[model samples]
Target: MRGGKALKHYVVDAYSTIEQNRLYYLRSHQENLWSELYYGLTDDFNRVDVTGDNVGHVVLPSSYTGSPRYMKQLYLDAMVVVHHHGSPDLFITFTCNS
Candidate 1:
């Protein structure tokens, strides 16, 4: 491990930094080398839906654990689980009065 990062964590962190840079570059320009590959081999779905021509997008990070996208994924997954197993039998919340 270098700089306290394990080998696997290093790769993940490195990739995340690279991705953050890539997204920043894409959004910084009207068009870029990256954009040329938007629907080509170096591709995935758009991070955001564009409504106008020649628009830009900011790629969401690889994970958006508490963001809208995360919530949507959670909701969809919950619906699927409930559909197969029925709704959960109990729902509970723990609170601290302080």
Candidate 2:
């Protein structure tokens, strides 16, 4: 990690069930380039449907064809590096709009 100030963007993804009401993927957004991983109770009602003592799995829709509503929260977090020497390995890069 560099000592100077750096630009950062954080994206988080959590999965929970209706019955357990557990929230997973509790972590810092800066450390990982990919979205955080979370696990929740299977019976979570707010996020999942629980039936027969089983909880449903919740996941972000990466792609959708029927409706755009499914992917309202799925996205990537990108940022630019301010001052740095040479180049450092990066997991995410900002796309310049021309």
Indicate which candidate wins on lDDT: 1
Clashing pairs in 2: 17-44, 18-43, 18-44, 18-45, 19-43, 19-44, 25-38, 42-55
Highest TM-score model number: 1
The residue-by-residue lDDT of candidate 2 on 39-84, one tens digit each, is 3322334555447654333442233222232343232111123233
TM-scores, each model vs. reference: 0.37, 0.16
* Candidate 1 whole-model C-alpha lDDT, 0 to 1: 0.60
Worst 10 residues of 2 by lDDT: 7-16
**lDDT at 8, model 2:** 27
Report every candidate's CA lDDT. 0.60, 0.33
Clashing pairs in 1: none
Runs in model 1 with CA error above 4 Å?
1-54
RMSD of each: 9.6, 17.6
